[model samples]
Target: MSPTRSTRALRAVDAPQSTLSAAAGELIDADPLFVRERTAASELPDPAPLVSNLARSVVEVISGVRDIEQLSRWVTDDVYRHLLIRTQHAARARQARRRPTRRPNFVELSVRIQATTENIVDAVVVLDFGARVRAVTVRLEGLDRRWRASAIHVL
Candidate 1:
């Protein structure tokens, strides 16, 4: 073949190979699982609202509400179990003390987020309940696009 014809043939061959390679790369990048994995690893939702709601729910539970069903929506099974046991014990203690169990009378609540990861967060919540201050540490995890409390420590 003539030099020009040979050059033209080479160019045509290389063009298709380059296009095929680029297409392969694009296909890999567009894979559903790969996209989902990347998004799941990189995406982190704001935790302020979640922490506030969870804190309020915990306070309500401690204040003789005993709404485990509603609390389940925002907490993990372990946390729910913990809350159930603790609330029951507190109720019994109050009965033993001959005092009627009632909701906490709090002036204000202050929430401080300690650490945040892609799917986990640690926070401290303080409630100014009339006579004294109550503080609790809460750890939350993101599951199925919603935040739920994984653990709680009352202080």
Candidate 2:
């Protein structure tokens, strides 16, 4: 039709506020030092792979086989600092024992995942280290359309 008709039709339509726009409002220089994005669970990928990979990488980091910096993008600042502290302790223990740094021989046995909320998942990754079994628990939160480890513990 006519331009006037189209303009009138558009004017008659009511538009609603977008969730994306609403979410973006929180990012407007509220805190210049720390800024993080929240993503909907449906917009994220499966957490299983990230959980498994992070578990393995964390073990390697503690064993001095991997650098903690490699995981910085996939974890929160608190988790990064915690992992760094653990890595330091492991390195010190190794130094005390005069053990040379080597990659740990391990196999991922299984992963158990539970969703605590739309944007959060708690998972346990079981690893077999030949002579022993260990479990790594990770809490993943959806951020910026991806998974970031908010908490991690090895036992």
Question: Highest TM-score, which number?
Answer: 2
Tell me the lDDT of model 2 at 95: 100
Question: Please, what is the whole-model Cα lDDT of each candidate in the order they appear?
Answer: 0.75, 0.90
- The true-structure Cα RMSD of candidate 1 reads 18.1
Which candidate number maximizes lDDT? 2
Model 2 per-residue lDDT at 13: 58
Residue-wise lDDT of candidate 2 within 44-131, one digit each (tens)?
9888989999999999999999999999999998999999999999999999999999999999999999999989999999999999
Model 2 alpha-carbon miss at residue 124, Å: 0.5
- Superposed Cα deviation of residue 132, candidate 1 (Å): 0.9
TM-score of each: 0.67, 0.78
State the lDDT at 137 in candidate 2.
Answer: 100
